[model samples]
Target: MQETKPQAVSRATDEELLALGRDVLTIEAEAVVALAGRLDGSFVAATRMILGATGRVIVTGVGKSGHIGRKLAATFASTGTPAYFVHAAEAAHGDLGMITAADVVIALSNSGTTAEVLTIAPLIKRHGARLIAITGNPSSALAKLADVHLDATIEREACPLNLAPTASTTAALALGDALAVALLDARGFGPDDFARSHPGGALGRRLLTRVSDVMRTGERIPRVAESASFAEALLEVTRGGMGMTAIVTPDNHAIGIFTDGDLRRLLGAQTDFRGLAVAEVMHRNPRSIAPDALAAEAAATMERARINQILVVDESGLLVGALNTHDLMDAKVI
Candidate 1:
């Protein structure tokens, strides 16, 4: 008999590889859309249960589900819900004591039969804490034991081998987001509330920070009497370190403001700084903000007016403080 060579399988072309990528995305997207349709009264009940709980939400899971649980817990905490993550394996070893009757436990398990989670399920029930399950299999033991089961099932895995968790994990994460947003809406959690939870971030600065927090007060405020010479105003501006000085009335109300830019304009007119009064070259009705206004609002006002500095005034129109763009930047409110 004559020897024969075996035929080799052809490799995928660039077009074929691109098509495969699109197919994976399409599968995952469809899986998420399907979860939306699967949502029912159970989801509403779960949201209510979370809202009604007097204590924090305890999230637990294993493997990839555990990773998702951490993010879910963080999202919950950041969005007005008191929540924290507990590793399922650790729960089996004595972490179950963390669960109290005041808490509601959310367990993530794609198979709904994860051994580590199953080990602690009954203990949670005994503690009088309600159990909410997010799982791909509604008929799984975890779902059957849950007070409310959220269906995160998908028709197929995005992985070609049908072994890895791709579409299922995406569905579970989307479902978690849906639940958190629903709770957020029900509780009327606004930007101000969100800012309180994020004091060190930009969003916090924009919403929680006030002009009074970043403005220069006391002797740091650059100011001069309206009758003072421009040379005196220049000295005040230099001492204040701000680019401008406020020309104030005898009662300390700001009548006008003089800036370095004003000096350039004055030089254009061949005027001597010592010969002019502070009021002569000052800008009347200069842009001013209230000390209580949000720092973000101040930044916006400066941007719209195309100015670098703004005066902070009290309700009496007195110059109580002053700030420049640099101050706002340093405060991280710009």
Candidate 2:
């Protein structure tokens, strides 16, 4: 057998790059997965602690964790949990008043030795509040002092340099999301309740806004007497821009609707437009809705019946209001 020449090593440096990515992914995935197994007594205990709180949740963190803390606090507040973020440094500098005995405190630290976080530990304990810690080090003072410690430790950083905080921050953020969502689910938070809290949102607008909000009442409503000339009704329609006018008797109950559609028919039939009255061309006993119907429901009716303008009358069928598709668009009911 002929002797084979030995292949020399290429001295390529790609192994470290590939291994760093794999190592970080593996550790971060394990951290999140381990959360499921560790979610024993602590998870339930945390939820009960938060739900039982009579005051807000005070979240505190240092450096990179502070950025995540602010977002978490905002999420909780907006979703009805009532929370606020406090910088650990500021907490040591008289900002501790932001927290009270009735509140629950959640502290975040990766190594658990962040000096700023440690400085406030004694105050947190003295406040008689429940302290929950999220950290990578269980033996650290911040973790040891906490009433409940959530382990967010990861084996390695995602950075190739392994100096910058990456996987650790990701693990902490994911854990925060898990905690918030779990609490939200336990509280049975829902859309209707959410809309109440966010009344400026679209869902709230649809639920809270009534037909009266967008209706044109009094002088803005286009109305014509049955005795009025077709020319007079056309003037009302042109002024109101609703493309229609309500035909009412002297008592003010809507008896018919005179529309642009009626105008087309009247003209095509070559009626003596100069002598015709609105009563001759108006649609008799046209459909009308009460002023109390939901704007969303009214919009639906308009779409289903192919009507652009609807007269808003009372239970007695008195023409008190008017609305068009443009009103729905302006109100965002569409």
Candidate 3:
């Protein structure tokens, strides 16, 4: 074996380096734009095929195409389509068992003639699984073998030598996104559906978290009767630590709310509080929300009403729970 010596590279000026970066972006952007214009009925057909598939979508490829395929599979799955990526070489080594007759296989190859992918194409077809090929060459074997072919050909690579997969990979990924989005629309996938798939994400918290999930229930909610003394209401607010206390009737119906802010304003006004009643100081018509409403809707209401806390009431207008800005923050719903 011969040892290879490294060569000294010439350093380019800052402006020259930036120019190269800009050129790469421009080339890749142009490739994507051109791909959008070249979209025809084949794109529509691919979407319809995936939408109609009774089983999962199996995305497979090799090399750079494999990376794109993996991302495409994740996108499809996250957007309501059941899909996953299987490396082409692995499929040849028995991973092909994952594919079923009802599955749809999406194969990606820039040249449309990857030997590893070609090796398994027949086996996939033998299983009676449908194939959708994304390749640069429409006449290539993979394209011809496919039930539907998506042309992802780019004018040229963004690589300086035009040998690396740059613009071509971008085009394929964009085409996959287009197909996934179209299928999402066809399935009528809404934010709630998306949130279900991403339960740990922020969107999920905003969409799926109801006020009842974060509101303080039972003894955690600070409550004082409307006939209670002002000092008793202040004591409940302090003990509750929610900065506010709900003033309820004898039957637990919320009548008004009083907060520390109200106390501060009262103190500033130099009002005598020796024998004041909670009903005398509490703000009537305090903002309230149903326990079943979204936490996001509760946050919106709080913001619009310029209040830090809201009382949760049932259909009968009985106090059920209470939450503040801190609770929303704790739930990560804000």
Candidate 4:
């Protein structure tokens, strides 16, 4: 057969394109907003069912609903609820075995008549698993069979032809997110728990990293005895390159801190350079944090005190390490 060339259509003006984009967003936004009003006891019941389940949440759908299901499953799993997506069509072809009596199945279908999802809905229930259906039609067979039906009905699709799934899918996704957030709150999921699931992310670095992990220790720390001359402390500061030096006692307990800022202020006030004790100009009772404290806490302390450097001290107040804003930045803890 000979192939025929396609005819070209007229291009849309920029104004027309912008208007269409705005319309789509408005429609989808309205659909999601409408869902908030429809939510009743059924929403709470679904959350309680999932919370009480001993097994995982099995999210299943097809087409655009499947895409939403995959995202919802990931959101659920990351936010303390154990969940995973299973394609409805695949569920019929041996994947149904993945569901169990203890599991709670969440099925997504805008029309609530998707054959692929309906085919395995009975088997899912027969396995003793409870079904939570999200659909546009409450009277559809799938919704009728569900233990709890979440109405996702929308006035119209965002698509110009009103055929493609758009507003409906967005509403379904927003509903799923609401469910997941409810479960997270119920389980008291916190930032620390979230950090554990996302250790490679910035929040993980801030929450999991400790002061000792990024502090300058040993010879890297700039230190001077209380009896040291101002010149000697300046030498240690320049050599350590931390822009500051810790003033310590004979037992190495931090007593004060001297920084480049203090040096500038002193130079402005007095020009005597022959003999000056670091103890005379050093800031006494410097802010310090424990080595085991979180690096984020260190950052907070520095920001609150408006200081660039802080000393890390042990239980006995002995200087163990030192860190500045630069070190926190290097570790990406801030």
Candidate 5:
């Protein structure tokens, strides 16, 4: 060939991808909205069934529906309801033994006629376990055979191709979240209760994080006499690296505190830093908290008082330790 033409390279720009994302989100939002509108007496029935359950809630599903079911089970378990996931295919085998008279089973299938789920409906009934079905089809075997049915149907999948389970799964997941939250609210589940169930998560930190857990102890604490010189207080604050020193009296009672804030105020005021006593410049009757008090409470106290440092004291008013805003931030108590 004597000459050749250069072909243009094709790639999606950010705007094009963002436009596609907006379409996907809009479609999925419609699915969730449709799912909300469909909620009626059936949703109440499902919530009542789950609330009346004195035993674990066994959730079962197949394929992508199964993945949504697993998340639903976890949410229920974390939010005051006891629940677990059982793969539908495994139920046909000896796994059915996991179901007992005291258990309530919630089965999910978009078609409601999923062979894996239909295969064990009879066995679940035989065990005297109550059955609840979440399905798209009303007349399907799983829904007809169940004690209660919760509708989670969607108009169409958000997939441009119309075959993938995109919006359908999103609708199912949103419905599951609704059920869990309703049951949680119905039972008056509080933050403290949720923290107990999730001791390893941030909820635990907010609810269980105590002042003593992150506070300094013994010799590491910054302490000085109320009558101590400014230089001595500075030494104590420097040694602790917390930018503050606790001022205590002869009886070991906390009298005041000298912090970096005090230092700035003093420097700006042109006070006699070289000769002034710490007690003169320090904050008198400084606000403090108990060791057993929650770290969140401490953070709130710090913020409300507009102070960066606080003294940890005992019931007898003796200074036990000191903590700065940095300590709370480091522990995520703030």
Candidate 6:
């Protein structure tokens, strides 16, 4: 049969278009806000169940809800909770075997009556796994079958036709985020843990990288004794490729530092390099950082001090390593 042509419709005015856009946003935002008040014992129970689960969280849904479930599963996994998304329809086709008694199943369906999701609910129960349902109608079959029902009921859809999933999906996503954050806090998932999960991301590099990992150590460090001549310090700086040299006492404790900037001031004064010792011309109490500090912290210190290089010291205040802004750049920690 030939497809019927869509009826010609009148174009909306600019004002009408703007009003519709604003209405959609306002409705969705209000739906999310109202979901906050609806949190009750069921919310708490869902959180505790997932937290106590020995296996991963299996999130399942169909259509738009499936898309949201994928995102929720990712959030849970990245935040220290092990989780994976399984299409609700696929669960009835052998995927249900993936569910174990140790795992927790979180199913999403706005009406609490999605046929595919409902079909797999019994198998999840038979596996002895706890079921958490996020749906709008708690009186529906899916809600009644769940071990914990999270009420995601909304006043209405943000869609103009009220047919497409809109406000309901937004509420479901927000509820998923809420659950993930609560579980993250309870498990004490910190920045380091987050970094470990995202090693290739910028935040991961900032959090997991340490001063020791990037700082130049041992022979790579530029150092000279306090008694060394200014010429010798310059040679050490050039050899180490750091543009500066640390002046250390006989006990190997850094007493000061001399940089290219200091040389300029000496040159302007016409000071005789032959008569000057590094100890006399070097800057006293130079800024330093601990080797155990985060590379990001070192970057912050350098930015605040307006300096390019920093000395890495041990607990005893002895110089162990050194690094400059260039090292941070190479490490991608800057």
lDDT of 6 by residue, 186-287 (tens): 999998899889988788899899999999999999999999988899899899898899989888898899998888899999998876788889999899
Task: For candidate 6, list the clashing residue pairs, or say none.
Answer: none
Candidate 2 achieves a global lDDT of 0.86
**What is the lDDT for 179 in model 1?**
95
- Per-residue accuracy of model 3 over 1-334 as CA lDDT, tens digit each: 9999898896998999999999999999999999988999998888888888899999999999999999999999999999999999999999999999999999999999999999999999999999999999999999999999999989999999999999999999999999999999999999889889988878889989999999999999999988999989989999999999999999999999999999999999999999999899899978899999999999999999899999999999999999999999999998
Instruction: Write the residue-wise lDDT of candidate 5 on 59-136 in tens digits.
Output: 999999999999999999999999999999998988998899889899988889999999999889999999999888
- Expressed as tens digits, the lDDT of each residue in 1-334 for candidate 4 is 9999998885999999999999999999999999999999999999999999999999999999999999999999999999999999999999999999999999999999999999999999999999999999999999999999999999999999999999999999999999999999999999889888888878789879999999999999999999999899999999989999999999999999999999999889886967989898899999999999999999999999999999999999999999999999999987
Q: Once model 5 is optimally superposed onto the true structure by TM-score, how far is the C-alpha of residue 179 displaced, in angstroms? A: 1.7
Best by TM-score, which number? 4
Candidate 6 ranges beyond 4 A from true positions: 1-26, 261-274
Give the poorly placed runs of model 4, Cα more than 4 Å off. Answer: 1-10, 268-271
lDDT of 3 at 45: 86
Q: Candidate 6: deviation at residue 177, Å?
A: 1.3
Worst 10 residues of 1 by lDDT: 271-280
Compared with the true structure, model 4 gives a TM-score of 0.91
Task: Please count the clashing residue pairs in each candidate, in the order shown.
Answer: 0, 0, 0, 0, 0, 0
Q: Estimate each model's TM-score.
A: 0.82, 0.63, 0.87, 0.91, 0.87, 0.86
Backbone clashes in candidate 6 total 0
> Which has the better TM-score: candidate 1, or candidate 4?
4
Q: Rank the candidates by lDDT, best first.
A: 4, 3, 6, 1, 5, 2
State the displacement of the C-alpha of residue 42, model 4, in Å, after optimal TM-score superposition.
0.9
Clashing pairs in 1: none
Worst window of 10 by summed lDDT in candidate 2 = 34-43
Candidate 2 lDDT tens digits, 1-334: 9999999976657997678668888867776776666666776777789999998999999888888788888878767688999999999999998888999898999999999998998898899888999898889889899988888887777776877888788888888878888888888987666767778867778876779998999999999898998899999999988999999989999999988977888679877877878887788998788888878878988899998989899988899899989998999988
Counting only residues 3 or more apart in sequence or on different chains, how many pairs clash (N, Cα, C under 3 Å) in candidate 4? 0
